[model samples]
Target: MRNQGSLRSTLHQRGMRMTPQRQLVLDAVRELGHATPEQVCKRVQGTAATVNITTVYRSLDLLEQLGLVRHTHLGHGAPTYSADEHEHVHLVCHHCGAIDEVPCELLDGLADLLAEQRGFALDASHLGLSGTCRNCRENPTAV
Candidate 1:
């Protein structure tokens, strides 16, 4: 889990002013990890509240710019926004499209291989990982 102060510091850096809409979007993102802009708006609307789709998208872009969020196409569409910033791999359920994250050790090997074989400098934090989640593993026929 990330500390609230860290998130506040990041918002402070960008001089992002607080808004009820943005706060609702942020809360939705924190609750539902790896979601699309449409998904975010839907989640926020679930509490008998309303926010424009444009507002949701704008907030996501702002968050990404501030490095407070990261995105990947783990599910579908352009990319999914996630509040967690840890360098981990995403495991997506093929059946339900559910997403889960796990620590990634792949970068260590890739880094070593690049240095030893190709002599290249690469940062693998931007890499995206995708696979089946545990539920899919247990229910193969669901997909």
Candidate 2:
């Protein structure tokens, strides 16, 4: 979780004031690890029933703009948000719909290859690789 003092300072630096709603939204994102905006709104509403989804969306956008959080598309669904410092590659299982995280270093070779061949800098942490997980691969019928 980011320091509350720093969060306030960062918002102040951007000429924005930190409200309780924004703080709750940020807290929800850090606590949930990765969540959609609706999930974030639900978590925030748990603490403050008056907080709404629109507030959560605006807060997420502001937090992302400040580099305090980042979003990644896990599948065809809504994007999931996570703290900016939470750096890792996401492994999404297609059959079971399971999500796992691996160190970003695991993609070093791919990143290098992309950079060399296509001049494309890969943001490994911002990417999700979809495939069958070990469990699903081992037990195809289980899915």
Candidate 3:
């Protein structure tokens, strides 16, 4: 999370005003770590009942544009938003829908391979790898 003063300056630099709703939305995103817009809206509304889902979506877009946050597609559902500084690769369990984060360095070798062979620079943090989790694999009936 960034300092409130810096957030205000960033908005001002873009000719935007810093509203309480925006601040709440940002606070929610920071506090929640990784959340969908709906989750953000719910968190914001916990403090400011007037803050709606539309505002959350708009704030998320602006925050992303300002490089304060980033979004990753963890599954087929809505993309999850996290602070831009939260750099990691998400390991998603296909069977139980569990999500785990690993250091971005874990993808360094694959990133280099793809860059050399396919000219693709992989943004490991922007997506998740889906696989059956240990629990699901070890105890098929548990899931």
Candidate 4:
């Protein structure tokens, strides 16, 4: 979860008008943790009861552009969003379609190696490593 107080100040510093709709959308995203725009819309409507899907999408786009939100394509579905705090990557389960966070530092050596050898500075933060989770590995047919 994000610090609401700091988020508000960040929005103000970014010159964004802190409207009730935007606030509601931000609250929904924060509360939902990793949520899609549709999920955010549903959450916002739970309280505001008047916000539309378009408003949620616009809010998400603006928030992402302002570096307040980060969206990741976990698997084959819509991208999931979370508060943008630091560099991180997603560990996606291929069988069960689960997503987990892995610190970007874990791949720092690989990033450096790629840069040195292939001249590619990999952006691990925006990448998802797909593999089988422990549970899925143990029960291969469960999926």
Candidate 5:
């Protein structure tokens, strides 16, 4: 679990002030581990002051720049946001579009292997590993 207060303080450390919109956005991100901008805006604006999509985008961009938040395009066009700063990898559910993060040193070794085999340094930061999640497995689609 992520500490909201500490995560808020990280904004101060980044020399950024927290407005209601930013806080709301951050809270929504913390609530929904990896959410796209639209999802974030909908949740943050729920029962709160009206917030535009641009606000979500700007906040996410600033957070990502400040290392207070992590995001990945994941070939989905829309970016997903995470508030946890600790290095981790992501598993994206292709069926339901859910995202989960887990810390794995083995992923780092795979990065090393890629570098050695292909001379390609990988940015495995919040890597997107696409597959069906457990939920999807349990509730397999009627194909």
Candidate 6:
């Protein structure tokens, strides 16, 4: 999770006032890990007693713009947000709808290959590679 101090400072530098609502939203997003705007609103309201969904959505957008959070469409569902900044690859299970994050370095060989052979810079962090997980593979009917 992102440190609250740095997030607040980033907002301050951007001339964005840090409201309790915004803080609550941030906390919700961080705590919820990869969560949608609706999930964030629910978490925040559960803690703070009141919060608007629109406000949560707007705050998420602003936070993304500020680089405080990252979002990715892991499957057919809404985009999921994460506060983790480390480079990583998202492995989404097509069968059970489970998601796992593997270190970005795991794809270093592929990245280098892409860079050398295709002259393309591969950002594995932004990718959500989908496949059937081991459990799903073992039990084809699990899903």
Clashes of each: 0, 0, 0, 0, 0, 0
Give the worst 10-residue stretch by lDDT in candidate 3: 125-134
Q: What is the overall TM-score of model 6 with all chains considered together?
A: 0.87
Q: Give the per-residue lDDT of model 3 (tens digit) for 24-127.
A: 98888889999999999999999999888888999999999998889999899989999888989998999999998999899899999999999999988787
lDDT of 6 by residue, 1-143 (tens): 56778888888898887888877877887787778888998898887766788889898888878877778878877788877564578899887888888998899999999999999998777779999899999988867
lDDT (CA) per prediction = 0.71, 0.93, 0.91, 0.82, 0.77, 0.83
Q: Give the alpha carbon lDDT tens digit for every residue of 1-143 in model 2.
A: 67889999998987989799988988999999999999999999889999988889999999999999999999999999999999999999999999999999999999999999999999998999999999999999998
Superposing every Cα of model 2 onto the true structure, what RMSD results? 0.9
Query: Which pairs in model 4 have colliding backbones?
Result: none
117, model 2: CA deviation in Å? 1.7
Worst 10 residues of 4 by lDDT: 1-10
Q: Which segments of model 3 are wrong by more than 4 Å?
A: none
TM values, all candidates: 0.69, 0.97, 0.96, 0.84, 0.71, 0.87
Q: Find the 10 residues in a row with the least total lDDT in model 6.
A: 79-88
Which stretches of model 5 miss by more than 4 angstroms? 1-16, 75-77, 93-102, 117-120, 131-141
lDDT of 5: 0.77
Segments of candidate 1 deviating more than 4 angstroms:
1-15, 93-98, 115-126, 130-142
- The deviation in Å at residue 45 for candidate 6 is 1.2
Which pairs of residues collide in candidate 2?
none
Model 1 scores worst on lDDT over the 10 consecutive residues at 122-131
